[model samples]
Target: MPAIVGAVKVINVSASSIFHIGDVYAMAPKSSAKTYAGGGSFNTGSGIHIQLSDSHTYVNDNDKFDQTIIGT
Candidate 1:
């Protein structure tokens, strides 16, 4: 099977007006600790992980994901 895995670096997303689940955004200043999910992990096709080292402001409460942020 064809698969892709990478570490994505992100920054300055707090003020963005638009958000989408699968939308790709470029990184500024390059963060770290990105991981891609696989089929065996959860019987799923593909996935991505994004993590921030420091606290960031949210526009609203709805943006927060229900699951644990670190291990998701």
Candidate 2:
């Protein structure tokens, strides 16, 4: 077996969400859904209403019959 006997420096490791350093198998894509409302920020007051809905897909399964609805 081998080992590092010196100091190690890591920089700019900007995953900010997901970071992998070692070997991996079957790395599925990270599922994500983002919903943003108009005029929604820290600069001003937001007067609009925000609604979110998600009928997420089944993970690690075969969806022979699947249905999803976001909104009306």
Q: For all candidates, what are the clash counts?
A: 0, 0
Off by over 4 Å in 2: 1-16, 34-72
Q: Cα deviation of 16 in candidate 1 (Å)?
A: 2.6
Runs of candidate 1 with Cα error greater than 4 angstroms are 1-5, 17-72
RMSD of each: 20.1, 13.0
lDDT of all predictions, in order shown?
0.44, 0.44
Q: Which candidate number would show the highest TM-score if scored against the true structure? A: 2
Q: Per-residue lDDT tens digits of candidate 2, residues 1-72?
A: 344345556665543344444555644433334444333233445576645454344345456534433231
Winning candidate number (lDDT): 2
Q: Cα deviation in Å at residue 41, candidate 2?
A: 19
Q: Give per-residue CA lDDT, model 1, range 1-72, as digits (tens).
A: 444646656664654233333435553342234344433333435565645456443343454444443432
Instruction: Report residue 10 deviation for candidate 1 (angstroms).
Output: 1.0
Candidate 1 steric clashes = 0
